[model samples]
Target: MNQEFKKYQAQTSPHPLGLEISHAKGSYIYDIENNAHLDFVAGVSATPLGHNHPKVIEAIKTQLNKYMHVMVYGEYVQKPAVELAKLLAENLPEPLEQTYLTNSGTEAIEGALKLAKRATGRSEIISAKNAYHGNTMGSMSVMGYEERKQAFRPLLPNVKFITFNNFEDLTNITTKTAAVILETIQGGAGFIFPQKNYLEAVRKRCNEVDALLILDEIQPGFGRTGKLFGFQHYNCIPDILVTGKALGGGMPIGAFTASKALMVLLQENPKLGHITTFGGHPVIAASALATLKEITETNLIYKTLEKEKLFRKLLVHPLIQEIRGKGLMLALIMENADITNQLILRCKDQCLILFWLLFEPKAVRITPPLTITVQEIEQGCQLILSVLNQIKS
Candidate 1:
């Protein structure tokens, strides 16, 4: 192990696919040994436009020459952040006109939860079983998996879990419920989608109970699902929508959107319900703005479905049981977690990087960049199938 990696870098797992990276461009990353590896993971689905996209990089340079962090919270009125918010307002659904930027997806979730409670004056929060919002304490409180969070017990109180695609459990979102937080696509849970009309029904139930609905679009936002936001695919709008991941192109950023009427609740009752030191740093916002521009202004958003079709068409193997999810946000279900593990490791060795979901061990994630070429898809799939043929059950 490298000295810095051994001493300073904390490992998320005892065994990591520790490949030292040199630089990346397009859909390829070069290691220190100059071995060019074809990227299929796209930095855990955060580089939807692929690595070092010229437009995104240019935006960062422009912003760097102008400004960086000006002040804390929403005090400075930075143009990149403000214009980015306005652009989101223009593209988003009705009443989702205002946005509060954050440093990461989990912070956006935290802000949404706080806003929901402040707006509804309710104490209970309802989330889905097998769902992942983030690793923060407030997010961990709602995580369905207990093994990873048991040691960090006594998180947020009054947090409840309901089945994701089951309308019957919607009764859990009662009048006392402050909010119902959910992933538009259950990312960590094998990219599991809500059954047809399930989201609409959930929206109706939330309205019936006067509980705010906070949809976590961290994974599937910014044209990952061939739509600006995954919630758009469901035809149901959330009271508060949290977005991140690819929102900053390759930069770390997050933002939650809501109606101005509802968002104002954060101002008066407590005056600054959520505050962060680097909430809307200008450079990050600039990259995000450029990413949004590329997705919306070009054909990148529409290309996702075509890329997804190519993936589905090529990823054929007897070991693969099912492919779940829409657009490019996808997963391949194997017979067991062991098989999934073997496949991921073998693919990495073969230069076709693959990863797994936090909650879905039997599934391997395949969320590539929207900019991934069709040839690249076929190439990666060929390598994947070859590995599957060579691997034993």
Candidate 2:
């Protein structure tokens, strides 16, 4: 199977943590040989309720008995999709009442960019440097890292980059800007949180220019950051709020929300301006709705902070430089990339799933499932510390 995977499947990274999984539940993944691996990365922060969560699975099962994909998105009034959108609006801030669902995070990012451009009638998009929105062309164009994007050059024109959390860089967002897209808590760039008032200042500047603020909550949404959305932490609501990852509860989904007045423009001027065949698939929406209800209704969202405290309290070591980020969205900055790599690979061999940040080589990702218990936190932290000690010895 490993040989077949390497030969048949197209490779993204040269070295992939190819774990042949048999099943998963709660916070652990079982291999084909029945080795129980404690999952710390939570499928890159997608499985908030953990693997094959009963509620999410039951929702999918129930939806399957009724319908799957009746019609392409927006054509048919699917109950799951409509209800999910409505529930999202009920939870989100005002003016972000309407939602456009998509298949994945990247697709949602693309749609949000289009919406911003359509509403503002401007093409210039200001994005933060070292930011990772998504890999799609529209999202990639705004990616601040040059090396990753150099190969995909001649991307969406009029896209510019600015350093995140740098107040001076806020000036680059001018009246000509259509939207300033940013990751509320910049993932893949060491899980960097916005400095004090940085997001607020950006909101002020965008308001001044009448430019839209599109916050990408792909990694930090769905109660991962101790709030329903990461933007809520800073008290600055985005004009267009993009969300995904944990929103699906292990299912694949994405959505962009804005004012009805602003979103209705797509329906009139272009008439199906942004159309997707399987954007709001009924089964996926059902799973998402269940996931959202479980998070908002239960204490899981608030428990994230408590879990985060336990992780911080237990993960202290000399080799660890610093911890960056908030809530479950965290990165441990090792002294160097070598140490980070060693810790991740060694921990994996020890049946603990650890991962690295996309752009930050010296950082290790620690985004576990929000449903993870205190015992799981202690277990994972102990494994991490053991690996660190071995490396130090």
Candidate 3:
């Protein structure tokens, strides 16, 4: 099976850990050998409510019985898709009344970029340095890191990058800019939060230049940051809010939202400027509806602070240089990448799952499901401390 995976899997596989997962529930994933691994990474923060939550499973099954695929997106007004769109419109801030659903975050980013250019009739986009939006050409064009994107040379031109959280860089957003894209909280850059007044400053600058502010809430949305989205913590609203990952509760789904006025641009001036056949897959929409209901209807949204406090209190160690981020979206920065890798490997060897961030080599990720319990937190933390001590010597 491993050989087959390497042979026919398109050859993009990372250094596979080869764990062979069999099943998962709550905060634990079990291997085929029946060994349980306590999950701390939560599939890189994609499983917000945890693996196989009963409600989400029921929602998907219930929708499966009724229908699966009916027609091309935005044509028949499918039940699950319509209901999910309505729920999103009702929950978001004012003027964020229209949602265009897609298959993944990268597609949503592509659609949003097209919408911005169509709405403003401009060609330039500004993204933060070290930013990660997605992998599609349109999305990759704005990615901050050029090293990873170098092989795909000559990306969409007119895409510029600025230092994240730097007030002096606001001048770069001139009238030529159609949109300024940023992550509400930098995910691949090790869960970095916006400095004081940084987002507000960005908002103000965008307004001055008449450029739309696009917040990529893909990783930090869905109650991860103790609010409905990470931008809520910064007290600023984005013109275009892009989301994915946890939105579908383990199923694949992505969506971009804007005001009815802004979204209407995609419907005209070259009618159907952006289109996708599977944008609103019924089963995915149904699963997303269930996930949104769980996040919005329960106190699980506000309890993240207490959960984060518990983690911080118990995670003390001499080797831990700092703990960064808010709510359950956290990173523990160690002394160096070598130690970080050893600790992560040792933790998994001990049957406790931990992970590393993309850009921050010295950082370890701790973004579990919101349904994780206090007992589970203590257990995971204790295991982490033990691994840290072993690595320290």
Candidate 4:
């Protein structure tokens, strides 16, 4: 199977953590040999309620039995899609009522950028340095890391970048800028958080210039950050809010929300300015609706901060320089890139899954599912400490 994967499938990284899966349930993934590899990454923060939660599965099955995709998005009145958007509006702040769904987060980013340019009549977009939005052309154009994006050059023009959490950079977001796209909490750049009211200040600056603020809550949204959205914690709301990953439970979906007025502009001036056939697929929307209901209704969202505290308490070690991020969205900053690599690879061998952050070579990702138990937290931390001890010895 491994040989077949390498031969047939197009590879992203040269070395892939090829774990042959039998099935996954709750916090553990069993291999073909039935070795239960504890999942720490939660499919890179996509599965918030853990793998195969009953509610999400039931919703998907119910929707599948009733109907699948009958028509392209916006043409038909899909019950699941409509309900999901309505529920999302109920939870989000004002002026962020209407939603446009897409196939993936990157696609959503593309749509948001286009909407910003169209609404403001400006072509310039600004992003944060070391940020990872997505791999599509528009998202990649706003990506701050030039080394990763330079190969895919001739990207969308009039894109600029500023340092994340830097107040000085807010000045760059002037009237010429259409939108300032930023992660609610920086995900790939070691889960960096907004500092000293930086997000608030950015909101003020964008307001003064009449530029839209697009917050990419792709990784930190959907209850991972002890809030339905990470921007809630910072006391700042974006003009356009983009979400994906955990929004669909274990399924795939993405969406961007703005005022009904702003979103309607996409319809008339360009006549289907941004359209997607499978944007609001019934089955996927059902899954997302279930996921959102579970997170918002239960105490799972509130428990994330408690779980984060437990992780910090158990993960103290000499090699772990610091733990960055809030709630379950976290990164362990190691002393060096070599140590980070060693820790991740060694933990994988020991049947405890850990991963790395993009563009942050010295950081180890620890974004486990929000539904992870106290016992699971202890078990994973013990395994992490054991591996760190081995590395030290």
Candidate 5:
């Protein structure tokens, strides 16, 4: 199966963690040999309720029995999709009421960028340095890291980048700018959090320049952060909010939300300005609605902080420099890139699943499922410390 995966499946990386899976339940994934590996990555924060969650699975199954894709998005009034969008509007702030669902976070980012340009009639899009929105052409064009995007040159023009948390760079956002997009918490940049009213300052600047603020909450949304959304923690709300990853429970989905007036621009002047064939698939919407309801109704969102405290309390070592981020969205910063790589590989060998960040080589990702228990947290941290101790010795 591993050989087939390598040969048949096109891979993003040369060395993939080819773990042949038999099944997964709760916080552990079982290999073909029935080896139970404790999952710390949670499919890179896509599974917030843990593996094969009953509610998500039941929602998917029920929707599958009823129907699947019947028409393109915005054409039919599917119950699951309608309810999901309405519930999102209820939870989000004012003016962020209407939503346009998409296939993934990258697609949502593309839509948001287009909306900003259409609304303001400007083409300049501003982004933060070392920030990662997604990998699609539009999102990649806004990506700050030049090394990864050099090969894919001649991307969307009129995109600029500013240093995140750097107050002085706010001058770059002028009247010519259509939008300034940023991750509420920069994910690929080692889970960096905004410092000292940085987000608020950006909001004020965008307001002053009549530019829209688009916040990409793809990695930090959906109860992974202690709050329902990371922007809630900071006092700044975005003009366009982009979300995905955990939104679909374990399924694939993404969405961009804005004011009714703003989103309506996609309909009339262009007549289906942004259309998707299967953006809001019924099965995926059902799974997402279930996930959102469970997160909001239960204490899972609150427990994320408690679990984070447990992880911090247990994972103290000399080789570990610091842990950055809030709630379940965390990154373990090792002393060097080699140590970070060694720790992740060693943990995997010890039957624990650990992963790495995209741009930060010294950072090991620790975004596990929000449903993970205290015992699971302790178990994962113990394995991490044990590996660190071995590396130290």
Candidate 6:
């Protein structure tokens, strides 16, 4: 299976941590060899409720028996999709009432960008440097990292980059700007949180310039940040919000939400601004609806901060320079890239799962499933500390 994966599958990296999985439950993934690997990355923050969560799986099964994809979105008014959208609107702030669902986060981002341009009648879009939204053309164009995007030149035109949290850079957003998109919490840039009302200031500046503010909550949404969305921690409300990753529980989905008036632009003038055949498939929407219900009905979101505190208390070592971010979306910044790499590799061998940040090589990602228990947290932290001690000594 490993050889076949290497031979047939197109990979993103030359070296992939190819774990041949047999099954997964809750916070653990089992390999074909029957070794149970305790999951800490939660499928890179996609499996919010954990692998094959019973509630999400049951919802998918129930929907499968009734129907799957009846028709393209907005034509059929599927119950799951409607309920999910209505729930989202209820949870989100004002002006973010309607939703456009897509297959993935990048696609949702593409739709959001188009909506911004359509509503504002402007072409120039601004994003932060060291930000990771998604991998599609429009999202790639806004990506701050040049090394990864250099080969794919001539991306969407007029897209600009700004330093996140830099007050001076706020001057660049002007009347001509269509939208200013930013990750609520900078993910690939080592889980950097907004500094001192920076997001609120940006909201004010965009309002002054009459430009739309798009917040990409792809990695930090759905109770990952102790709140339903990371932007909730700060007081900044975006005009268009792009969401995915954990939105569908364990299923693949993404969505962009804006006011009904703004989203209607996608259906007017040009007509059919963006369309996906499988955007809001009924089964996926059912899974997402169950996931959202679980998050809201229970105290899972509130416990993320308590879990975060426990992790901080346990993961103290000299090799670790800092632990950045809030709630479950965290990164452990080691002194050097080599040390970080060694810790991650060693932990994998020890039957504990650990991962890395995209742009920051010296940082280790620790976005575990929100359902992880205190015992699991202690076990994972002990394994990590053991590896760090070996590297140091």
Q: Write the per-residue lDDT of candidate 2 for residues 1-393, one digit (tens) a residue.
A: 998999999999899889998999999999999999999999999999999999899999999999888788898889999999999999998989999999999999999999999999999999998999999998899888988989977899999889998999888999999999999988978888888889999999999999999999999999998998988889699999999889888889999999999899889788999999999899999999999999999999899998888889999999999988788988999999999999999999999998988899999999999988899899999999999999999
Estimated TM-score per prediction? 0.98, 0.99, 0.98, 0.99, 0.99, 0.99
Model 1 lDDT at residue 211? 92
Candidate 6 regions with alpha-carbon error over 4 angstroms: none
| Candidate-wise lDDT, in order | 0.90, 0.93, 0.90, 0.94, 0.94, 0.94
Model 1 error, position 221 (Å): 0.7
- C-alpha RMSD of each candidate structure in angstroms: 1.1, 0.8, 1.1, 0.7, 0.7, 0.7
Give the clashing residue pairs of candidate 4, or none: none
Q: What's model 4's lDDT at 383?
A: 94
Worst 10 residues of 1 by lDDT: 1-10
Tell me which residue pairs clash in candidate 1.
none
lDDT of 6 by residue, 1-393 (tens): 999999999998899999899999999999999999999999899999999999999999999999888788778879999999999999998989999989999999999999999999999999999999889888999999999899999899998989998999999999989999999999999998999999999999999999999999999999999999999999999999999989989899999999999998999789888999999899999999999999999999999999999999999999999999889999999999999999999999989999999999999999999999999999999999999999999
Q: Write the per-residue lDDT of candidate 3 for residues 1-393, one digit (tens) a residue.
A: 767767777754467666777899988999988899999988887889999999999999998999988787888879889899999998899778999999999999999999889888899999998899999998989888887799998899899999898989989999999999999899888787899789999999999989999999999999988988888888689999999999989888899999999988887788888888888899999899999999999999888889999999999999899999888999999989998999889988889888888788999999989989999999999998988888877
lDDT of 6 at 220: 96
Q: Write the per-residue lDDT of candidate 1 for residues 1-393, one digit (tens) a residue.
A: 466786799988887788988899999988898887888888998998899999999999999999888799788889999999999999998989999999999999999998988888888999988889999999999898888789999899999999988978987889889999999889998898878799999999999999988999999898888888888877799999999999989999999999999888888868887889998899999999999988999888888898888888888788999999888899999999999999999888877888999988899999888899988888899999889998854
Q: Which ten residues in a row have the lowest lDDT in candidate 6?
A: 68-77
lDDT pick, better of 1 and 6: 6
TM-score, prediction 3 = 0.98
Q: Give the Å shift of residue 290 in candidate 3.
A: 0.7
Which of candidates 2 and 3 reaches a greater TM-score?
2
Error of 4 at 248 (Å): 0.6
lDDT of 4 by residue, 328-386 (tens): 99899999999999999999998999999998999999989999999999999999999
